[model samples]
Target: MTHIELSVLIPAHNEAGNLPALLDEIALALSGITPVITPVINYEVLVMDDGSSDDTWSLLVQRAQHDKHLRPLRHSHSAGQSTSVWQAAQLARGTWLATLDGDGQNDPADIPALMQAAIDEDAVLVGGHRVVRQDTKLKLLSSRIANNIRRRLLDDDSPDSGCGIKVIRRDAFLSLPYFDHMHRFLPALIHAQGGKCLARPVNHRERGTGQSHYGLGNRLWVGIVDLMGVMWLKRRSRLPALVTGIEDSELLRGESEAVTQAHEESVAAHVVSSRMEALKG
Candidate 1:
C-alpha cells in the first residue's frame, strides 16, 4: 500500500449535525495543500464516532460512499475524546496526523498551514492557538483559568493547551503514555517525550448547529484529577541523551583484527584443499 503523508482524525460523539460540513471543509482544505514529501497531497480522513446515539455512523457511511478519503470508525459505547483519538492513532496510516474537533468550531482551513508549520519547524507537534476565541465569556474565563493552572503545574509552555486542532507525528504520538483526558495535555506529553511542540495561531469559530459538549462540570472539575496525574508523569519523565557518535575502543580494534586473521586463515585452508582436490583429479 502507498504510504499516506497525512491523516486527518476527528473524534465525534453526538456530532452528526456538525460533521457533514466539517468533512467538506476538510476535503477543500486538503486539496490546496502541497506537501514537500509527496507530489499530490496523500491524505486520509478518519472520523471516530464515539458511540453517538444520533445519526453519526449512518452519515459517515453515506459520506464514505461519495468520498474515498473518508474512513469512519466507531466505538460500541461513548468513549471520551482521549480514547477516541488514541484508538484512531493506532489505526491511522500516515507519517503525520492532524486532529480537529467534531463540533465544527475548529477551522479546517487552518489545517494546511499547521501542517506546513510542523514541517518547516521540524516539530513533532504543532498545536493551534485560538487568539480570538468565539465562546461565551464564562467559557473563556474557565478555559483561561485552566490553562494558567496547567501551564504553571505542567510547565508545558503552551498558550492554549485545550485547543482541539493540532498536527502531530504519528510515531511520536504512539510513543506517549495514554490515559483519560490525555488529549488536553498533548503539548506537555509530547514535550516530555523529547519532541518539539510549536503553537501556531489558528482560526476559531462559534458552534454552528449543536451546543458545546464541554462545560464546567466535565471540562474544569473533572480535569483536576487528570491534571495532577499529568503533573506526576511530567516530573517523572526524562528526555533521551543526544548521541553524537560511536566511540572507538582498543578492545573493539583487537576483536576486529582477530576476526580478519581468522577469515584469512579459513581462505588459505580452502585454497590448499582446492589445489589438492585438483591434483587428485
Candidate 2:
C-alpha cells in the first residue's frame, strides 16, 4: 500500500505564545488518527514565520530541532498570510495540504475530520465552517457581511471562507493564481479549476495572546477588493471542449501533443482574458 503524505502549513506573524499549544494539539491529533489499509501515513507540520516581530521564529526553530517532522520556514520580510501559505505550498512535500492559522483560533483536533471529509468526498478543497467563532462582535459582523457578499458574487457555497482551517490537494492549490488575499477565496478558486469543495463545521477558539491584526473596516475593505478580483477571474475562465478518438499509438502521441498545446493555449488565453476583465472592472 502506498503511504499518503499530509502537509500542515501554519502561517504565523507574532504567534510565539500560541505556537507551543498549537504544536502540541497537532501532535496529539496526528497520533490519534490511524491510517486505514496503509502501512504508513506520513505527515509534516510546517510553521511559516511571516516576518514575525516577536520570538515566533526562535520558538519554531527550537521545536523543529526536536521534531524531525516539524519544519520552520521564515520569510525575510512581512508578507501577508496568502503569500506565506503559497511559500509553504512550494516547500511542502505532501500530496495533501492543510492550512491553519498560527493565532490559535483554529482547533487542530478538527484537522483529522477535515482530512477524512476530503477522502470521503474526493474533494480537492475541504473548508472549515466555524461552529462557534471566538472573535469580537465587530470582527464577526465584518466577516459575516464579507462572506455573504462573496458567496453571492462568487457563487461559492462555502459558509466560512475565513475559518482558516482548510484541507486541499497540493497540486490544485499550486495551480491557482497567487494573490495577496487569495486565502479567503480558496473554495472559489478550487471551483474555478474544475475541482470540488466541501465545507465542514469546526471549532474556533479565542486568541491566547496578541491583538487582532486587522480591524473591522480594513477587513471589509480588503475583502471587497479581493471579491471583485475573484469575480473577474471566474467570468473569464474557459474549460476545454471534450473529444473522443481511437487508441492508436501514433494517434495517441499526436493527441497528447495536441492536448498539451491546447492546455498551453488555454492558460495563455486565461491570462489575456484576466487582463481584459480587470480593465473592464
Candidate 3:
C-alpha cells in the first residue's frame, strides 16, 4: 500500500450508529485540507472494531466496499481502547497519525488545526485539549480527577491527555509501549523518548448515538497500576543525547572494534587448535 500523509485512527466498540456520520465528517474535513507540505494529501481513515457484538464490523465492511478511504479492522475479542488504537496504528500507512473517539464526541474538524499546530511548534506530538466538554458533570469530574492524577504522576505537562482527538507522528506513536491505556499518555511517551508535545484546544461534542462502552468507575486502582508501570518505563528508559562529544563517539567505536578483534582472534585460535588435532590424529 502507498504511504499516506495522514492516518485517522478510530477505535470503535459497537459504534455502528455513529460510524457513518463520523466517517462522512472526516471525509469532508480531510478533503478540505490543503496540504502546504506535500503536493498530494493522501490519507486513510481506519476504524478498528474491538469485537463489538453489534453490527459495527459489518457496517465498516459495507462502508469500505464503497468508500476507498475507509479501512476497517476487527478484533476477535474486546480489546481495550489503547490496544485497539495500537493495532490500528500498526496498520496505518501514514507518516502522521490522527486519532479520535468513535462515539462522535470528538470533532474531526479540529484535526487539521492540530496538525498545523504540531508543524508550527515542531513537535513530535500534538494533543487535543477539550476546552468545553459536552458530557455529564460526573463524567467530567471523573475525567478531570484522572487527568490531574496522571499529570502529577507522569509529569507529561499536557492538561488534557484524556481527550480523544490527537495528532502525532507515526514513529513516535509506534515507539510507545503497547499496553492498556497507553493512549492516555502520548505526551509523556513522546517526552520520555526525547520529543516534545504541543497541546491545542479542540471542540468537544456530545455523542449522538449509543452509550459509552468503557468508563473508569471501578477501575481506579487499575489506572493507578498503569500509571506506575508507565512511570517505571519512563524511569528505566535511556534516551541518547542529540549531540555527543568525539570522545564518547570514539569510545563506542573503540569498544566495537575491540570486540570484533577479540572475536576474530578467538576464531583463529580455534581453527589452529582444530588443525593441530587433525594432524595428531
Q: What is candidate 2's lDDT per residue for 74-153, written digit by digit as tens?
A: 77656678867876776676778899999898998888888888888888889999978898999989999999999898
Candidates ranked, most accurate by TM-score first: 2, 1, 3
User: Number of clashing pairs, model 3?
Assistant: 0
Q: Candidate 3: list runs displaced more than 4 Å.
A: 33-40, 239-281
Model 3 Cα lDDT, one tens digit per residue, 1-281: 35467889999998989989999998877785554444446788889887799999889888899998988877776767886787677667776899999999999888888887888887888898888899877677677777778889887689888789999977677766566677877788888778878888999999989887656653345666667777777776575422222433222211120113344345346545643543343
Counting clashing residue pairs in each candidate, in order, gives 0, 0, 0
Best by lDDT: 1
**Which candidate model has the greater lDDT, 2 or 3?**
2
Candidate 2, which segments miss by more than 4 Å at Cα?
A: 1-4, 33-40, 239-281
Candidates ranked by lDDT, best first?
Answer: 1, 2, 3
Supply the TM-score for candidate 2: 0.83
lDDT of 3: 0.76
State every prediction's TM-score relative to the real structure: 0.82, 0.83, 0.81
After superposition on all CA atoms, what RMSD does each candidate show versus the true structure?
Answer: 18.4, 7.9, 13.9
lDDT winner between candidates 1 and 3: 1
